[model samples]
Target: MTKLTGRLDDDRRTLVLTRQFDVPAEQLWTDFTDPDRLERWFGAWTGDPASGQVMLTMNAEAESVPAVPCRILHCDRPRRLSVTVTDSFGTWQLAIGFDEDEGSTRLTLRHEEVDLQTVPEVGPGWEWYLDRLTAAVAGEAPPTLEDFVDTYAPMGQDYAVMISGS
Candidate 1:
């Protein structure tokens, strides 16, 4: 498994997360865009994945949150995707960029226009979910939310401090 870390770009109000996968860019893109494939890792989504609104029900065993409504902003197959997500907390933008090197794929997930105060929670959540994606891609069972949260909770403090410069 690869180390999960995110770069905080205060100036841009973005949290940039990166991951390198042994699979091709197209495979990674399918994991994200195809609802069936997405359900294997990330939340299950309904509606047109290419363009338009979608509803996502996050798959979790404990502390499950409500389904979020998202609007697809851009979709350039196997390359880039942008969406606006809205939930009880608020609305935010998420962008994913994929680059292929040889047969491997590098994914850059950017959470844009974010409220820095939420870093402690959001950072760890993304880390766990992304790791689940990695596991799914590797044909392994996804970890339960309890396990993921327990393992990643401590890292939230590190991310908070990094983003706060304190």
Candidate 2:
């Protein structure tokens, strides 16, 4: 598993994780922006992104979940994407960055304004979804939710410590 980091930026809590893929940034960009491709790993979104908002239905969840409203804050094609999603849990500000080096792409996922107490569960959830993205990119079966919970649930305290820096 990849390492995760967290910080307090302007008094707002944020968590960041990076994953490297042996593929060009273009491929990863498509995987991130295309609704059909996103459905394979993350979720499928509806509505025109140009409208600055979309309804994203997360299909990878273990059980049925309601779609969330995602507001696009910024979109720099093939480079960065920033959005704020509001769901039953709360509001999540997410920043996604794509950087390419030596034909490999490094994807950075940053969640801003996170609640300190939620880091444990939130951290592993993002990692699990990213792993699903990796599997989709490689045309492999995604890891099961049971496996993720079994393996990473215990590490919640670790995430909490890493984010709290205590």
Candidate 3:
């Protein structure tokens, strides 16, 4: 299970999730920034990142999926990455931070300026994705979507109550 926290930043709501791995920061950074490595877990991206934009395909769902346009907002190599992703659903302001301590790396993912109404779906979605990354890094099979729906779906109520401050 993952622990997600909600807070306000600059009057905007933010949801954060963190995971710790017994891996070096450099390796974790590569897993995030390297296109090939990213494909193993999340999705593949085309176009040069230096150009500030890329078309990302979420290949985990369908073999032939439309690519989404992602604009890089802030990038600090091996440390932080911030981007705005526009897809069919909506625009997502996402950021990931990597911190290494005592030979372990802690990955923090922040979904910023999010609508409180979407917390139920958005929170578990990230938990599933991060678990996928964890599996990829461990060289294990990724969790099936069915597994996520069965296990993490109910946690949405918890997230709702949390963000609602009730």
lDDT agreement of model 1 with the native: 0.84
TM-score ranking, best first = 1, 2, 3
RMSD of each: 2.1, 2.1, 2.2
Which regions of candidate 2 fall more than 4 Å away from where they truly are? Answer: 1-12
Q: Assess every candidate by TM-score.
A: 0.91, 0.91, 0.90
Q: How well is each residue in 47-161 modelled by candidate 1, as lDDT tens digits?
A: 7765588898776637687888889999898899999989888898999999999999999999998788888888887888888898899999887766665787778888878
Clashing pairs in 3: none
Error of 2 at 119 (Å): 0.2
Residue 17: error of model 2 in Å? 0.2
**lDDT string, candidate 2, 33-139, tens digits:** 89999999988999999999999999977799888999999999889999999999999999999999988999998898888889898887887888889999999
Off by over 4 Å in 1: 1-4, 10-12, 61-64
The C-alpha local distance difference test score for the whole of candidate 3 amounts to 0.84
* TM-score result, candidate 3: 0.90
**Pairwise TM-score winner, candidates 1 and 3:** 1
Mind giving the per-residue lDDT tens digits that candidate 3 earns over 61-97? 6357799999999998778999999988899999999
- The lowest-lDDT stretch of 10 consecutive residues in candidate 2 is 1-10
Question: What lDDT would candidate 2 get against the real structure?
Answer: 0.84
